[model samples]
Target: MVTPAGTLALLHTSPVHVPVFDGLRDRYHPGLVLRHLVDEELLRRARSSGSDAVAGPVAAALAAAVADGADAVLCTCSTIGGTAERQAGALGVPVLRVDRPMAAEAARYRRVVVVAALRSTLEPTVSLIAEESGPEPSFVSTVVVEGAWELFEAGDRDGYLDAVAASVDRAPLSEDSVVVLAQASMADAVERMSTRRPVLASPRLGLAAAAEAVAASAAVRAGRD
Candidate 1:
């Protein structure tokens, strides 16, 4: 009657991510336990020093946290895939980089456009996703929304999502193609967009997959016991 699920630790760059994970946890299992590690300063430095500079430290921090007891580590930032993978490799634990699932999903479509709030966040993610795609989608591109981050920082959260939604609305989203939102913050607006094209957010995909992984791991462990 009792199911023993493992711990899932989410490492994020800001407090904004907490809500997303909480939503996932509530839906997946009432008993599912979750934890967080926020590196706001690293994010601040990344803003000026570039996304790559912050990746190493953030991933290393997450690795240490997982090694202590966490069953899995999920990196919420889409901009630091390389660093996260490196850290995941070193830890030898299940590290779910958020974008991989979305990227894999996007590969199912012919043309895919990734909408991102920051240029620094877009390039690396687009590259990594494109590389994972193998065949290279017809158009793997980014639509950058300038100043959305400032609105978020200024406590205009709705404005930020509205602005992002407006940008997504304006995009020439193809009916047959898929649209992926490159940031976790962008995940909130997918339902608001009335696009014929599919909109994928890495965090949602990652969290859903992580929940399943947690369930499967628990089942396997129970059998072994």
Candidate 2:
């Protein structure tokens, strides 16, 4: 089915993301339409050969969404976030990284703990944090939850969350540190984690940002008309 003209299309790399994003969209932007396009291979390719390997395909997906009448596109995979942002101008609509708002929030802290299931997400997420933090000096540390992705791949979501939580628990986190969940899939694990530090998750913040972008685009078009 063709999505409505004002639809917010989410480009995802995991099938499990549909319900999570849909729930967020329903709660935050119920009036707006929603669509999801999953490309599992994109993440796999990114993990194996780096984001450059999936940049072209990701750009194509964005272009297709725009052509299909998406008002805004949310790249829900951090692995391809840089590529999505690079192609945003050409897409003629907002193409936002899902971790953007979380990164921005993370930048406010003097120190940040970035937790991820995959190594591929570290660079883009840290770069986003730095970009948002801008000129201000901040300390950032990365913790990759070993074998967490394997659990996720095996459909053992509970195991995945437990592993992530365990990894965070073992890290030398303090009350002053801000913990950033580097991947959207890892967002739920934060709640399970016991930490005094503030935890940042992407889904709600990112979707809210995308909703505002869609509204802004519509306003601009209405003004032109």
Candidate 3:
């Protein structure tokens, strides 16, 4: 059996995506090869409304990984996510952004609330999901505590969840509403806060999709060889 290989070029802006990818690796196992690459500063700058200037470097790094033999690329960060698609085209391989799946799902509802970890993730995620769903759902966004990253670095899991959940719970969601986690790291909280509405996580969806893409690519390569 030829062990398959895939790389999760995580544009890890924060520590949250680490656990998200870990969950994916645990669930998918040997069938889906996986790893992560972190570029912390780029993510922070991108989340702060920095232009594709930051994304360019991150994409270049990912492009290098693909050149290095990664069969597929999975980007787990929400902000600067649009870069993934562009990188995918440039690399000529499967590249998936964390928001794509949840965006598709969230679009099915009439109204949606996105609990993004950062302001930069909110609009892009909502817009992408809206484009897919057609009837463009109403959108709302809320930022958790400003220093949520500090709390995370301090190993305050409870504090991190509390701040995120609180921000999400307070958002003005529609009466008939759907909720989506803008960032992959927010998956756990999505499950915990799935009260009164549906909560979707991007990392879970992106990873599953990426696993399939990598598997398909490997199968095709083997057939040709």
Candidate 4:
């Protein structure tokens, strides 16, 4: 009998990520079961008060996802993603931040340009990339896609993507600098970029990592049985 793919849950700060990750699952991990949970308020609170404000809630969400049959949980909110990943040991499951894979790849270069639409996302992303880069990591610069978040919040997705793409074009990138798009929503901006530079985004890369994690965990469970 074929071993079934384990279920993966995605925690999102905005509802828009639901379709994006779902599309990724369909494209790559067709057999993987997926559950999506969104809490717009978690991000809202983190942006206002700080990431600590949502630490407890992020933990609760991860636990709830596990209890609900998720073998792995992927947090899609860049703002509070670090807090969520820290709960992985307590959850005893793979709780991953979506930016992590992209961060790991971005950290390889001598210079990196991280682009985000919100100030709240910028710091967490930089921290994640820095951790991946180690002590002597690359020189990382940040670019905020000004006026883009408002467009996203206003449901102007096309405009928001265009703005993100425009920011990449305007960024001061050297030939060696790899560009990292800080949010999953910014993935499409890569295709929209005119600059011939390597751009990394979270959605596809993150989901692939999550799928690998699920497969690894499942193999272990199967071994035990």
Off by over 4 Å in 1: 1-4, 215-225
Assess candidate 3 and give its TM-score to the true structure. 0.85
In order of appearance, the predictions have TM-scores of 0.88, 0.94, 0.85, 0.95
Best by lDDT: 4
lDDT, candidate 2, 1-225, per-residue tens: 222236788999998999998887666667778889999999988889988988899999999998987888998999998888788889889999999999888888899999999988999999889989967756999999999999999999999999998888888987679889899998888778887678888998998888888887767666788
What lDDT tens digits, residue by residue, belong to model 1 across residues 1-225? 222467778878779899888876776555667788887777677768876787668767876877666767777877665567567666756777778788888877778888888777877677766776765455676798878888988988898898888888889866677888888888988878777677888876787766666666556656878
Please give the RMSD to the true structure for each candidate, in Å. 2.7, 3.0, 3.0, 2.0
**Candidate 3 residue lDDT tens string, 40-110:** 78776775656477767877878887877677777777777777667777787788777888788777777
Scored against the true structure, residue 40 in model 4 reaches a CA lDDT of 94
Alpha-carbon runs more than 4 Å astray in model 2: 1-5
Off by over 4 Å in 4: 1-4, 223-225
Q: How far is 148's C-alpha from truth in model 4 (Å)?
A: 0.4
Name the 10 consecutive residues with the lowest summed lDDT in model 1. 1-10
lDDT, residue 187, candidate 4:
93
